[model samples]
Target chain A: MHFGPHLLLAALEGLVTSAVLALTALGLSLVFGVMRVVNVAHGEFFMLGAVLAWAITTAIGGHPALGFLAALVIAPLIVGAIALVAERLVLRRLNYNPEATIVATIGMLYIIQQLALTIYGPEARPVEPPFSYRILLPWFGYSGYKLSVIATSALLLIATWLVLTRTKIGLIMRATQYDSETAQAFGIPVGRVYGGVFALGAMLAAIAAALIVPISQAHYLMGQDPLLLSFIVVIIGGLGSLRGTVVAAVLIGLSDGIISMFFSPTLAKIIATLLVAMVLVFRPQGLFGTASR
Target chain B: MTDKNGFFDLSKSTLTRRTALKGLAAGAGLGLAPGFVRYSQAQSSAPIKIGFQSHRTGIGAAYGRWYEKTTAAAVKAINAAGGINGRQVEVIIEDDGTDPGRGAEVVGKFATQHKTDIVFGTLFSHVVIGSAPAAGENKMPYFVVSEGHHVASTKLNRYVFQPGITDVKSQIESMAPWIAANAGKKVTQIFPDFAFGYDHRDYLPPALKAQGADVIAQIAIPPTESSFTKFFPQIPAETEVIYHVMVGPAVLTFVKELGEFYGPNRPQLFGFIDSLEATDINSPGLEFLDGSHFWEGSPRYAQADDSVAQKAYRTAVGIDDNGAAVGDPKDVSTAAHMFGCWETLYVVKKAMEDAGYKGPEDRAKLVEATEALTEFAEGPEHPQGPKTFNGKIHQCFGIQNISKVEGGKLKVVHKTKIEDGLYEAEGDYTTQAL
Candidate 1:
């Protein structure tokens, strides 16, 4: 309960939040970067991942670790498939028009949310962590699984960075992002790249939800907060900049935790929002975002 | 004829328009015409429509589901036993989406579109507060089951009533004596930062102080907060009891984090059952609450000395001994508070009958009738317990159950008397104009 330990605990908690926010925001950033269309249903995809995790784990009915591992692998894949179908049926049909796709994705959000509510019911159900180790500090004990989430997120971020920088698929996506018409002219299959990027973005969100479900119970309405936070990260980190998204997520998460410790939580939120507003006024391009061409 | 669903079959009514006209003609010819009496008789056959404002899709949806079920069961019972004023009771539901703006709009729809005689069955305090002005503007009697002190504080208009459940102010006040005597003297409170939390934050200290105990620390967490370990350090080192009352989906995480923070050497934990309503007590990460105590508006787990009415009420509501749905153990009922929905419906029926309520025109009479009632005895209709109604403030005073978490189930350890929660009236709703 001392100042040092309190600050340390706040920072640790903030790291876990930042890790999830980074992954979720990265998904949104990628879709915008390549497709130039906002996916409003991104949060619902995250919710779907968590709900599917619950169903898969319950169906498996074995060791908690086995079920959790199964969820980690399967939930994202299922969510990604669903996202692909949405792109084909809705987004592709809209010709990926920015305004039309925004509306279409909003429709998808409701459909996914209502479907989850109907199938999963209105309860906030918790999933047993893969492991239940408590890291007892001299000051307080912490969930070992939470720390694992941070590490897992970091590894995933690195893998994603490696793919974007080094792989042919990443090269195709980036060329399409830079100029879809030019990429198409060069036989890059711009449409296919868009579809793959959309699916991958959703998959990232799903993965984050799966990781956080043990720490926070999966409820039908749980997507709202994450969606809002991810949007903040996406906007403040500079849209379409993965690096900026990760950095902004960490900055916002840590500040939120530290500020809340000093002031009332409501006041903390006001201060955070004011800070975001100031950033917007001073640097419209965001902290790392370049000026638009 | 009445249908099996307890609604009247209007097609099978014996009194046709022709027959009514003939009766009126005959009465006029006999110089015994009583058109008003005949009109009243015809109107009495129509069903009483009660509009239910539900939280079907938002944060309060879990509680809303059980509230809907309890309301249905209560309505079915009331109709089966000859409903209010010999008319069938019909419920029309409108989801409020658990948003204050949506709540007010729903109340307006209930008044103008549904044309319901009364709007009832709202649970969340914010929703109730937001909807009350619309009810007052429309002059539709609004009977909410929300346990918020807003109704008792007389801050809302005269149309709003909280006759179904005791408000949070009374519930919090009642816990002080029992907590100070049994739990601990130096208490630290942890609650969500909102109107609901403010009720406890503002009321508990004075009540505890009166009982020779003091609240050492009060930590208010943001409503959106999911992680709580960072805030755990705010509890004073000399704290003896942690009185936590949190609501919403992240409650499981909060408890889990609290457990990890304290490990095995934590202080005594006393929390309002609102924190875990509709949640399984034996859930993973809740091992820390094994011996903690909670305040239950109604006992979730059936006690050995449960009254006959309580047993019958549980059966009627389809809740088992463990307070889960009869067949689904995992689908836990919000047994602590959902009983208010049932009890409130019965109160509505009683008031309607007392007022001879036949249509919306008699809404004022119905409100007056409800306010005139003073007490409800423990029976099939009033299953939670006997309660004293403060008609002036439009809130109920009821005994509260203090239950301990033992053997992975909440066992009733103490029941506070109604007087323990009674406080001087803040204001009188009767003083306001209808």
Candidate 2:
């Protein structure tokens, strides 16, 4: 194949996948920084956002913006409410057992996926891409929308960083993650803090689902890949550290992009997982994790 | 578009109005013309029930929708032709969601409570395997439209039949030799870790072994897996052909991923038939697979001109009626499915007419007549295809091989018309023989 077509396609594929990877890791970072529980079902939340976006968007004449708006606005509110209820009912009773919470969230994942299948059907509902614009770069072609994913996700990432570091709610959310008991001792309503954090996490997932799904499309099973990748990102970047997650997200994204260009998709993932495992074993708390943690 | 005789010419007789009215008066109670009355009967008492289970939201939705569209069109056509021995046919469709348990439940409802005349359309292999037993137990004739080899393997049920080349073997049989003959005679395979992808990849190497072709390596990642670039370095360097068994979006992702991973600097790539999709040819990563060959038994969307029967099928189903090749003109899944259902119904109609269906109560007699059919000779539904039922196997025979596009049309590069029993298969359940 000619280099023009080859490089163009590689760039497009990398852009699509990297966008999803960054957004998914962003959610994990937000959740770990606040609730201190790895929301295993974050991918499911992403999936819900996609399905919700797809349902609304497809029903209303194939508009991605509607789905994006629906997902961005409604998904967090709904899944946040569910997270609240889940917190009250389940997480509250777990006595803060990290392992138990992890297992419970895993259960939540299957339950949600099965429920979705029950109601929506198991087949993939491919959402029409929001727009069709191919920019030809001197014998190479790239979808305008694909480039948009990167641009949009980058904006979201920057906005999230700004909110977490610059806003009042962001300060409280971080205080809760640093020390829940002390945050409560210092007059922070830990319950409300948890709710806000969960909502923020859900919102990140929804936005990612809404934005990235235009390329990968949406399906029930799509949640798993990003979920797994997000976990790797969190582990590599350092749990509960937004800055670290961002660094690792970019590193992993770039690594995957470049490696995939030279290898198969399956091989690229295998290599990424391998690298993450090695890093985890060698650097227990992750690249940026505090030694105390 | 034609009668049982396979002739579309209505030029044989031109009668005067007086003569036509006289003939109408002579056969006054025959219940034939002004077909509107018959369709109105479709909304009548008990809703002439036929059950269909399909993947409404699963991976098979594309194929499932086509099946539904074609079936709906055939029902309308049947009603126009004075439906099912004068009782208009009404199909009650259920979404199986592409899950076996869901499929089983839908079949249970159709065979028991809904009590349909026949049940048709299950898109997944495991779903068919799980639900076929129930259809056989209840003696309800089940028509499946899946590509799983397992259904053909069991051959246990007397009531279940899925027409065409029932296995993925046909593809391997066609490709292994061809890839060996070209592409440096060394092949590496990559597929999804799940049942759908694993089966084809697993089935192929053995098939290649039987064909005296050497398989370099086989790599499988999880189904619906997002990336494959990690494993690229591990691929045996001697490998030349890459058989891709990935399907749907995952396949799209894999191809795009592979395109990026393996450039012109890498070995030449090939793929399993399912991965050769025309719709995704415009995918940014598709340039990598442009010249890659695929072997499949399914009718290609970009292939040869529409056969006479296919043209009639297009007209019967409100499809464009333009051309019938895989990956070109349009998604041919709709046309392909319409042909299968249309042909199945045509065979049932001929059988019922031969056995003299007085009403829905004659279900037993209808099954017997269906069992008794020896062959179908170039009928309006089959056109150039055949419909032969071995009373022993309860299977109908015929299939079109997969094709690739050349100059905006798909053409089958392999496969020859074979004898009827060449693709014969039996059901997978015990049945009370009619």
TM-score of each: 0.93, 0.65
On residues A34-148, what C-alpha lDDT tens digit does candidate 2 reach at each position?
7778789888888887777667665666355665566556655676677667766766666445777788889888888878766764444445556655565543335576678
Name the top TM-score candidate: 1
**DockQ, candidate no. 2:** 0.07
Q: Where does candidate 1 chain A have its weakest 10-residue lDDT segment? A: A263-272
- Residue B296's C-alpha lDDT in candidate 1? 95
lDDT of 1 by residue, B196-255 (tens): 888999999999999999999999887777778778888998999999999888898999
| DockQ of each candidate relative to the true complex | 0.34, 0.07
lDDT of 1: 0.90
RMSD of model 1 against the true structure: 9.0
Error of 1 at A249 (Å): 1.5
The lowest-lDDT stretch of 10 consecutive residues in candidate 1 chain B is B32-41
Kindly report which residue stretches of model 1 are placed more than 4 angstroms away from their true locations once superposed.
Answer: B1-42
Q: Summarize candidate 2's per-residue lDDT along B65-92 as a digit string, tens digits.
A: 6677767877888888888666677789
